[model samples]
Target: MSETTALSSLKIEEVPQKLQIKNYFDLKKYPFEHEALFKREKVTSVIGILNEIEPYAKDWLKNKITSAQKSAYKPEASVISEGSYNVILENGAVFKPAAIIGFSGSKDTHTIYIRKGASVIGANIYLNQGDIYVGEGTVIEPGTAIKGPVILGKNNEIRQGAYFRGNIIIGNNCVIKGELKNVLMMNDCQFPHTCYVGDSVLGYCTHFGNQATSANFGIMGGIISKTITLKIDDKNYDLNRNKIGIIMGDYAQVGCNAVSDPGTFLLPYTIVYSLVRIPKGIYGPNVILKNKSFEKGITEVASLKI
Candidate 1:
């Protein structure tokens, strides 16, 4: 097989319109060893970034399913399709689904679409509405709630009690369990346990430690202040959106219980230490964001006189 074919196989379909910001992300600075990684992720669109890069969410249930069958979206186990959407299998991977799973769509009815090798384990799970797409080798643990218009890519683990809302796409090889909405995650991302990530786009290999959160709403309640105005070199710029979360690049690790102010943009390899409240700004790449108390800064514990 040609190198291009191999590269394109794992690539998420690209879209136009780069991320709209000056010097926010320098893709050239991404320390990726493989050219394939750059090819898959190198999008410069600033306007509606996810909407432009998101290849799967544009099509409705019917279209996504058909595309999944042809693509590498493989399901190891058999899919017990029992819902409103039609299931079609043509020249594709073999799916010997072990058990007949079901959907309880009383509150929000959804069409569950699972590719070959994907497993939905145990009972007590519910998908409220929209179409659910489970990619190859992915596992949805018991007691998870997924409200649809969502897609899970290859080799992902959606742990127990993970709740999801509409307009979401989880990329390949991710381990995530959280309350989320309108989020797009890239490959090798690990985010689990008690985080509320809303209206955000996380890059490759990003991990959010326990109880960390991206506070999307910058506006204080009851007063009509909604837009997130960012200050760069004393010039304030508007993102032109009310709901904006942390836009973290690849290999960014958020320490436990850290809270990101709205419109926080973290570049690649940024490490935020525990309990650090990241301010709203365009943080350049490879920054170690940590909270330093004034007392700690003033004097060291060992040096201070008792």
Candidate 2:
């Protein structure tokens, strides 16, 4: 087989208009209505948008929590309030409010909004100096521990042993069973089984199979930290941020045990096969990436001199 066939299986379906966030993501089908927060005209680049929206997104999330806290319309479900902690339950969703702890020891209030048809049974919610919003029909199973300052959209299944750090925004119908922090996940994305995703943006219908990881940091720290750069079509673009993960586009897939290096970016419909280590760069839309060693005829029996 040819070398090109062993590496990338499919050709690009369509080229993007620009290297902007809008070109990669399907904003029309994005579950969250926070496009204004992206400041599209101000920061068109994908990494630029993420850097520009970090503080704004946190503020927006806090505002949402505050608004929900002051809501006058009583839900038909159970609401338990004690001191600065409030747990709102709907559709028989059950969890011990005491398990939700104020880990930061701050004076700020903590609110958990579990909407209708959602459940958080036996899950531990850590009020890590922020609030949590669980949308309708989401299920957070036992052994899952979630740190607050998150907005989870409708119908997500957060399975057992899943761990979530703060500052995350998730869209509808996702299957999350991983360790996540500071990320935005769009509609229908899946990270089923143990995985690690941090400081990233996952687009619509993306999937990360079991044990898939996005390495977000440089190996060597201090004054001489490695800069994250993305090379696409012979052009090198440096992302100024110190830490970055993957900026996966819509319909992308990372196979089981696959790992993406820092500053990796996948265009729409890109599929990375299992056990592959994707380098720090920009990849394609409608393409299949695989290791050459995985080819069927590559293995040959040879005697070792040792």
Candidate 3:
């Protein structure tokens, strides 16, 4: 089938009544194209928006960078830059940023945009291929390797050993210490410590404990389709996407070492206990899900999407 014909056959929706979920999943500021986890309905929406504004943003950023390189950008005393990416130094600041230490990029595939008050403290941190855009007042610590097409908003903490691949968007005042690819984190969210958040979308102030993970793809896999379903109780909601991971709503918290099954969708203020293996379904807005490990579950990380 043709692409348009195939997309016309797909529809994504949320089933709140299945898990008895009510007043969960807000729609207001959602479907932001920069975000990774969004309703399948937003797919076409993003394409249209990107077609309009992406070129403009690129051109504007390029010209601004060129001007900054020629006239205004002044490297701080602590920096050890390779001089590959352009730097924009906003003047009249009280304090300057720390050393850029080490950074890498793909050939014309990405650019690194760092706003003022952004700091990269310590060593072994590298920004590799693709564009990495850090908004104002963000801090990145040591041992992290970030690839581009990632957008980080203001006042965030990109802590140690944080690994990122392409297509991730993080909002303001957030913390990310996990391994993420194609993930979207709303404002005030935290992914502190060892975790894998792939193809997921986390809402405001949602946080994960150490070692929390999202199992994104099929385990017994052959050909993985992006269309999947969310089963809550006897009801099934067609997600219309094959590679859906965790879609967590606002104020949700997962305890240490929690492993969510593929396509786990939790609503606002939901809490899952430590070492729990979350089932594949949509959960409540104000519920507490306590769980214990079965020990019979096989390790599923080997089948993860790259």
Of the candidates shown, which would achieve the greatest TM-score relative to the real structure?
Answer: 2
Candidate 2 ranges with C-alpha deviation above 4 Å: 1-18, 29-32, 40-42, 52-54, 69-84, 90-93, 103-106, 233-235, 294-306
lDDT of 3 by residue, 164-233 (tens): 7666777788888989877767787878788998877677788999999998877854554445555444
Per-residue alpha-carbon lDDT of candidate 2 for residues 130-173, written as tens digits (9 for 90 to 100): 77888888989988888877888889999999898887888899
Give the per-residue lDDT digits (tens) of candidate 1, residues 121-156.
641222444566778888888767676677778888
After best superposition, candidate 3 residue 18: deviation in angstroms?
Answer: 7.4
Which ten contiguous residues of candidate 3 have the minimum total lDDT?
45-54
**Lowest-sum lDDT 10-residue window in model 1:** 297-306
* Whole-structure CA lDDT of model 1: 0.62
Which is the leading candidate under lDDT?
Answer: 2
Could you tell me how far off, in angstroms, the CA of residue 276 lies in candidate 1 after the best superposition? 0.7
Residue 55 CA displacement from its true place in model 2, Å: 2.8
RMSD of 2: 8.9
Worst 10 residues of 2 by lDDT: 2-11
Ranking by lDDT: 2, 1, 3
